[model samples]
Target: MPVTLRPLRVAAAQAESVAGDLDANVATAVHLVSAAADWGARVVVLPELFLTGYSPQAWLPELTTTPDDPRLEPLASAARERAVVVVAGAAVRRSGPDGSAQRFTLSLLVVDEAGEVTAPYDKQHLFDTERAFFAPGAQGASIVVDGWELGLGVCYDGCFPEHARAAAEDGARAYLCPSAYVAGSEHRRDLYYAARALDNGIYVVFAGLTGRCGGLDFSGGSAVYDPEGRALGRAGIISPAAVVADLDPVEVARVQAENPIARDRLGSLGGRSRVVVAGPRP
Candidate 1:
């Protein structure tokens, strides 16, 4: 039996942030979500730590958030009202009281059209500076939307091909990366994103944070690529705006059939296959 999934209209939100300003940041996310929905988007992706900006450790006292953080309600409310799926980022508080409070860079809110949170996926890989303040998430969690499994990663997670390949192995047909990557070093991130899609034969959806934060400027080259490693569309460097593209799972399957990168093929020699990890650029 041939399986099928609905093609999604997806948009990415790029924003200039005010670090540690939770209220204002949430408001800004709400505004972007509304704008994206207006453009007929069925799903929208926001940058990493969007609700409290990218730098939170320096403002720990001001940048606190619970799983049921009230700050995220507006995004859910807008999703429910607009009948769209919203994926917004935030620094999530992870603790059950007795345990110490650890912050995870979370792709916090995954709101369905019914205006309810269907599922939420946190970032598994914490970047260099992020390791100091954010705790890493375990593997295997993914967001299932309308029969398509969407794998979620933030920032540095995109640099790790294994993370994305694991998602594909777990039945993910698409991967969503919400990032706060800066210029110069962004090419490394971009290539890995492309490699993940090409290697796994899945779609890649990347949303990047723009403008400056903590004295560093973000690259903001948000983009989407097909399974064949072809870029469908890109938001361009340093530009902040929303763009939509159609994702077809059938095409992804076709590409996988043709490329067979992730498939194990039988050989005359038998029981041997080579795989390698491409490292970060200089």
Candidate 2:
């Protein structure tokens, strides 16, 4: 018998984070996750560093937490109660090589419906300003939910085609970018995200932080794109919002079969290339 592909309802949330407030931010994330679940979203993605405002300058150290921190339990509980996958951001602390001083990395925490949290997926690409505080992650990361492979990326990572390409090569049918882009940049970012989807033949979901944080206003253009690079759903750039869309794996398969960009690369290059690690995934 042939297999059937089910549609996966996914959501992207655009909201501001309170700087240096873990409890309040976690509460907000839980609320957003619950709201998405209410809307029948199987997977809800929040903005980058939503748990601790995207203030890399001052709040980086203040907001850093270990993966097993007790404060994160509320999010896990909410995921279990909603029976949905919750992806949120935070600063994760890890010891340096050979037990050196602790280092922080911008990361996403994936909480399953069973309340089990996966290891932190760090952001490999750092924006110019972010490098001063957080260390870059080591590799790319993806999670399989309901037999769908969903890849993860942070703000600036979405700007790099190689980042999404690496995930696509790793069998990701969709790429989720949790970002904190400032106001006035939404238009360019939207085009970039669409191109990423078109080039990879995979769904692209962008969740951006909105409102003001640390004296900077954010652009809230949260959106979901289909494999054809069409906007399935999108939120405005002015306020906190959520965009939900259904992703069908069958559509991805159909697009890949028709376009064949992912598979045609080697033959197009005359089979003279070898793959190399573009960057790190944590």
Candidate 3:
């Protein structure tokens, strides 16, 4: 049998989020997922909050969906039929105290080729202004599809090293980020991704939303980075298109072995921990 994950075709769907239009958004997502599968992508990543767009605070209540809501079934169906893994975003509803529902800008799910939800990781870090309307999620997870273990992060979660580190430590060979990074935040799309890839010794795939949402201009620099901090390719700052790349696990391992920044440091941590705590604490 051929190596299913040795060279995986991955696509990043960089599309505009239709503000507060769940039906239209779902249609667009399904269309993109089909397009990705046609392009021979085994995995496809969508933008953060794509299902309901990056709606402002006022629209949060309208976009909430419980975990068992049927809205997610469509995406799962698409994944099963397409024989691809999808990581998409939504404004997910969570159980609050007293039976109230809490809303979050969550990366709602993971659907495999068998249409099963093998992993689900919500957005743990809410962006500025988002905290006013959304609650943070505590989910941390990774999914294995076709022998490739993938770590999923949504939007702001990409900025934190700990989130990426946790994912890397948990056996994620690739990190998939679905984002809605805005205009003034282009540096992270440019600089941070390379740094994270170098630091984690894994492939970093970022998919972002373009165009305006609630008056904020988005800069969609959807991209992929190799373990050596090389930019494979990227979408334009305002373009709505799909960016695809053939990922190789061998190349990922080769890059890390040659550089060995994160790997070396991680090895030393065990010994360093002994020295740091060698003395008694007061």
Winning candidate number (lDDT)? 2
Instruction: Indicate whether candidate 2 or candidate 3 has the larger TM-score.
Output: 2
lDDT of 2 at 53: 83
- Candidates' TM-scores? 0.86, 0.90, 0.85
The order of the candidates by lDDT, greatest first, is: 2, 3, 1
Q: Write the per-residue lDDT of candidate 2 for residues 126-200, one digit (tens) a residue.
A: 888888888899989999888888999998898999999999999999999988888898778789889999999
Q: In order, what is each prediction's RMSD in angstroms?
A: 5.6, 7.4, 5.7
Alpha carbon lDDT at 78, candidate 3: 92
- Best candidate according to TM-score: 2
Residue range with the least summed lDDT across 10 consecutive positions in model 1: 55-64
Query: Which portions of model 2 show Cα errors greater than 4 Å?
Result: 1-4, 96-100, 266-282
lDDT of 3 at 173: 83
Writing each residue's lDDT as its tens digit, candidate 1 over 164-279 gives: 88888899988888888877777676687888899899998888888887677787877888887777877766445876788897888899898997786333556777777786
Q: Model 2 clash pairs?
A: 138-280, 138-281, 139-280, 139-281, 140-281
Ranking 1 against 3 by lDDT, winner: 3
Error of 1 at 103 (Å): 5.2
Score each candidate by Cα lDDT.
0.76, 0.87, 0.78
Q: What TM-score does candidate 3 reach?
A: 0.85
Give the Å shift of residue 57 in candidate 1.
5.0
What value does the lDDT take at residue 137 in candidate 3? Answer: 71
